[model samples]
Structures are given as C-alpha cells and as structure tokens.
Target: MLIIEGAGRWTTPTDGANDWVEHLRMPDLSVGTYCIPAGGLDDQSPHTEDEIYVVTAGQARIVTPDGATEVGPGSVIFVPAGEEHRFDEVTEDLALLVIFGPAYGSRAPAHPAPLRPRS
Candidate 1:
C-alpha cells in the first residue's frame, strides 16, 4: 500500500502561479496533487500517456481538442494520449488529484515537453 501526506511537500511549479505535488508514483502509474492559483495555466502540450484529473477544490477550465469545459470540485477530466490540453481560468486556487499510467490499464510512452502556453 502506498501512502502520502501530500500536504506541504511534493510541490512542483507548473508556472508562476501553479504548483503540483507528486503524492504517488510507481513504475506502472503515477498520481499527483496539484494546486492552481488564480489565473494559472500550465502550458498546453501533447501527452503520450493517458491522464485523468479529479477536482478537489475551486474551479478550472480544461481546454482540449473537443473544446473547453469548466471543472470544479467533484468534477473529473480525462485526456487521452497525444491530445492537446491545458488548464485555465483557475478561480480561488484549484486543487486536483491526477492519475495516469499502466496502473490504470494504459501502456503508453512518456512524451514530455517544455511548459509553454499554447498560442
């Protein structure tokens, strides 16, 4: 069993206003806890792995190929591999629980890129 306090530790800066804490990670999958401050938008990039975001607090807008949608507490968002997506319109500092990987029945590669807002 994996356990994480994930309160003050595990924070990785997404940008100027956004930061995320890696609460859990394994060879098969990984889980992250994020905090998006007001007006935070992580760069839009293509993902090589499947990802799901569960909103824990506040609100955010997720922009994808299909379109954009508002995500808030109790809401969930999924992004398939190679999909262009981003987080925006963060209100009142958004907190999220992110999960992705082979742990979730996915066998995709990791395609990481520089964090840059989509233009």
Candidate 2:
C-alpha cells in the first residue's frame, strides 16, 4: 500500500510561486496538491487527460468555455480532457487536491485543428 503525509503542507503559494506538488503516480491515475496565492493567476493550459479538482481550502472562480463557477472548501469539480478552463478572481489562498485519469501527462498533447472556411 502507498501512503502520503503532509499533503496540505503547501496550502498557499510560497514566495509568489504557484506550486503543484505531485504525491502519487500510477499507470491509471495520479494525485497532487495545487496551491495558488490569493490574487494569483492560474496560467495552466488544458490537459490531454481528464481531471478532478477537490477544493481543500480558500475560494476562487473557475471559468470554462461553457461557463464559470465559484469554488471553495469541499467543492469538487470535474473537467474533461482537452477542455479550456482556468481559475481566476481568487479571494483567498487556494489549495486543491488534483486527480488525473490515465495519469497526468500520460497522453500526447492535442493539437488545434486547422480552421476551415464556412461551406
């Protein structure tokens, strides 16, 4: 059995560095902690694998191509692979438990399709 401790140690960004500390990795899944300081920007791009985010602390708004939602402690969110999303307008330090299916970065990055003229 595998075990991890102090998963919440990095609940807030340190020295202005947004941190993502991976704790567990397997063939089918992976887990980690993501911390962004209040007012910090989330510049992460869409991943090739599906993701689940569990808000452990703090508050923020996650904006996706479809819509946006407010997240706080105990909030659980799911994002599909290749979807555009980001967290913004953070009102407090944000800490989240992130899980990726098929393991994070296990798949090749998706390329944007060439635009086609309207028929």
Candidate 3:
C-alpha cells in the first residue's frame, strides 16, 4: 500500500495538481497528494481527466466559472474534465487526495474488477 505523511506540513511551490505527488498510477485510476500554500496564487488550469478532491486538511475557497465555495477538511470537491477551476482564499495549507480516472495516457478500465473485501 502507498502512503503519504505530513499533510499539513507538505509544501509546494505552486498551486493545484502541480503540487501533487503521484502515489499510484493505473490505467483505471490515479491517486496523489496535493498541497497548496496559504495565500498563494490560484492559477490552476483545466484538466483533461475527471477528478475528485478529498480535502485532508486546511481551508480554501474553490473558484470556478460557476462561483466560489468555502471548503475545509473532509470536503469532497468535483471538477469535470476540461472545466476551469482553482483554489482561492486559502486560509491554511490545502492538502487533498486527488483521484483521476482512466489514469494518465491510458484508457479507462474496460471491466472493473471487484475490490478485495477487507479482512
């Protein structure tokens, strides 16, 4: 199993997925950790893959063409493929579990296999 430590302390030079450290890369999905520094610029570009952001720590206002919404720990945010989105008003470092489907440079899983049951 892959694991990352220090969600609150992880530092990045930029905002958004650029801060993300790839933990797993599969043809069906990918997972990583991203940290956006507080008071940093929000210049996130659109993505080609659909994604979900599972907030691990800190607070931020996610801005999109639609509007802005305040989010904190445990917040689940979704951004569709090719949609403009970014994080603004970051009160604290924003750490997230980013999941991207169909992996990078690969097609989606043709048939999803059943996950192994937890012991």
- Estimate the TM-score of every prediction: 0.73, 0.85, 0.74
- Which residue pairs collide in model 3, if any? none
Model 1 ranges with Cα > 4 A deviation = 7-16, 103-119
Q: Among all windows of ten consecutive residues in candidate 2, which has the lowest summed lDDT? A: 5-14
For TM-score, the strongest prediction is 2
lDDT tens digits, residue span 1-119, model 1: 65666643324455565776666668778787777677776764665678888887877788887999988888888788778888888775777788877443345455688799979
- Weakest 10 consecutive residues of candidate 3 by summed lDDT: 8-17
The CA lDDT at 53 in model 1 is 83
What are the per-residue Cα lDDT tens digits for candidate 2 across 7-116? 64446566897899989999999899999899999999999899999898899999999999999998999999999999999899999889999899999666799999
User: How much does candidate 3 score in TM-score?
Assistant: 0.74
Please give the lDDT score for candidate 3: 0.76
- Comparing 1 with 2 on lDDT, the higher-scoring candidate is 2
**Candidate 2 ranges beyond 4 A from true positions:** 109-119
lDDT of 3 by residue, 1-119 (tens): 64545432456654243375777788788877778788766676777788888888889998888999999988999988878998888888878788888664354336678799899
Query: Given candidate 2, what's the lDDT at residue 5?
Result: 76
